[model samples]
Target: MEYLIPFNRPFLTGKENEFVNEVFRTRNLSGNGPFTKKSQAFFENRFGFGKCLLTTSCTDALEMAAILIDIKPGDEVIVPSYTFVSSANPFILRGAKIVFIDSKNNHPSLDENQIESLITKKTKAIVVVHYAGTACNMELVMSIAAKYKLYVIEDAAQAIANNYSFSDKSKKFLGSFGHLATFSFHETKNISSGEGGLLVINDKTLVERAEIIWEKGTNRNAFFKGIVDKYNWVDVGSSFLPSELIAALLYSQLQSLDEIQKKRIAIWNQYKNGLKEWALLNDVEISYIPEYSGNNAHIFYLIFNTSEKRDNLILKLKNKGILSVFHYLSLHKSPYYKDKHDGRELVNSDRYSDCLLRLPLFVDLTEKEVTHIINIIVN
Candidate 1:
């Protein structure tokens, strides 16, 4: 048998070792160092975000966003049922009621058309996850948010370097549109820092509070910058920042973002092309990338005709020494949220939970490996 191909893996290139060695030489491995500052600056300058903070993980970033928004008990936050649990867990931890919405047909993102009906008097925010680096209908989501006067938090975990273009010639990065957005540099993401993430703040009002929360409720960030005489407890918060070492690793990935993105896109396209005929024959659906969106090709998934077929495909792949996987069991149906679920059936979300299968697509995967994986699926 061939070497088992895993679903996704991180690739280290360029300055990974160089930066890590620099951090070691400097002996400043704690939060907020030269690498952290450089990483924050890179994101702010390249993505046009108001501010960026490197966090321990995307989960921490979401929690920071929840803290900034003051998600009190009974506050309702609308989110897609098809996303990772971290997207909604932060709000839940803060005592907010999660209003889970279904995905749109043919896509893993929340249905913008359905968002309005789910909003009630308690709706404080809308959490939109850019599933697989593809953009959601932000225009519709933004309009609904404006009408309701709610905060929009983007879970752009898979969307680093991805952009959404508008007809008016304006282009916005995935993390740029939301009041606050979170990104992951987990080992599985396009960029990796072993286990790291970032929080991008787009709203000026939230920046100061966000920093305080990021620094464990203290005004330490201000003190460090000489903006304050001493740092002390100012509000409720947690330790959200990662060590300088992680930032150093991520800075290396950021330097080669363009090259990584190009290679990933090529792999994604190869899968799409290889499976096109099989998909058509089986009446299955392939992931769609809208023209207005620039995807990072962070993931490549296919939807089978039925849940049974999806399961069989997984078994087949595993037997063949290929480790394909499924993503996101609908949060509404999970044990934690089932009792709290709103009395609505998430049709599209359920469909996605049952039918989607992610193939092996990684930065280090070779053309031959991709062809082999696709051949297994097609056959």
Candidate 2:
């Protein structure tokens, strides 16, 4: 059942092995070693993030953020219903109640206008996912959070190496605007360490505590920084850091990010241009890019008029040895959360749950192969 074209293939920058070998030579495979520092510095210097720490996965980073923010039972956190489970799961684990936000009609990001109405006295935070690397309206989101005095965490797992335009014609990285942000370097993401995550602390006040939470609730980082003579457990935390080996591989990936993004954007453009006419004729919806968001090319998805058409198309592509797949189901309607939902329908989230289809998108996917995929889909 091996499809000639898989849904995703992790790209290698060729320097990964060399970097990992260097880590082995340093004889420090532990977390927060030389390789980890190099990787973290790369992000901080490149994105101007306040402070960055690598974690085992994005979920762990979010969990650390949850702890830093002091989430408590009965506290409410607003999250988009069309995102991966990790976006809400971390808050839920801290006993915070999740208030699901609906997606925008023509885009997968949460409707920023609806965020204000969902806040309450008990609301503690708003978690925004920059779906497909396109930003949610950061200006409005931050303003609302200020008005309500709520925390904002950007689940920028797919948003690395991308920019968000401001209303003043200024721009910044997607992960920079939120008080705390998390990113993934999963094999399928634009960047890869196979299994790694990052937490960016934009709020200066949270920086010191975030480091404590990252080191399993200890002042271990302070000790290393020579700020403390002795380090001991001081708070609740977990083993959130990834091994130095993962960071080594990631540093290599970071070195080639521009090259990788260039190729990915080209692939996304091919899909858009190739399918434009076919989409209009078939009454289907192709990828949508908001003017304020950079096209990071994290995904190029299609939406059929009905789930049947999307499913049938996936099956058809499979028959041709091409792998195509559906994206997230609405979290509010999921079996685990169905009863927990407030009975309010999130129409756009539900629509994407059924109609959205993701095609093969990887660095190795060539122009000829893309054309072939387009030809099959159209005919």
Q: Please, what is the whole-model Cα lDDT of each candidate in the order they appear?
A: 0.92, 0.94
Please write out the lDDT profile of model 2 over residues 228-294, one tens digit for every residue.
Answer: 9999999888899999999999999999999999999999999999999999999999999888988
Number of clashing pairs per prediction, in order: 0, 0
lDDT over C-alpha atoms for residue 237 of model 2: 80
**Residue ranges of candidate 2 with Cα displaced over 4 Å:** none
- Estimate the TM-score of every prediction: 0.98, 0.99
Candidate 1 lDDT over residue span 259-322, tens digit each: 9999999999999999888999998899799878887899899998799999999999899888
Local error of candidate 2 at residue 292 (angstroms) = 0.7
Instruction: Say which candidate scores most in TM-score.
Output: 2
Query: How well does candidate 2 match the true structure in TM-score terms?
Result: 0.99
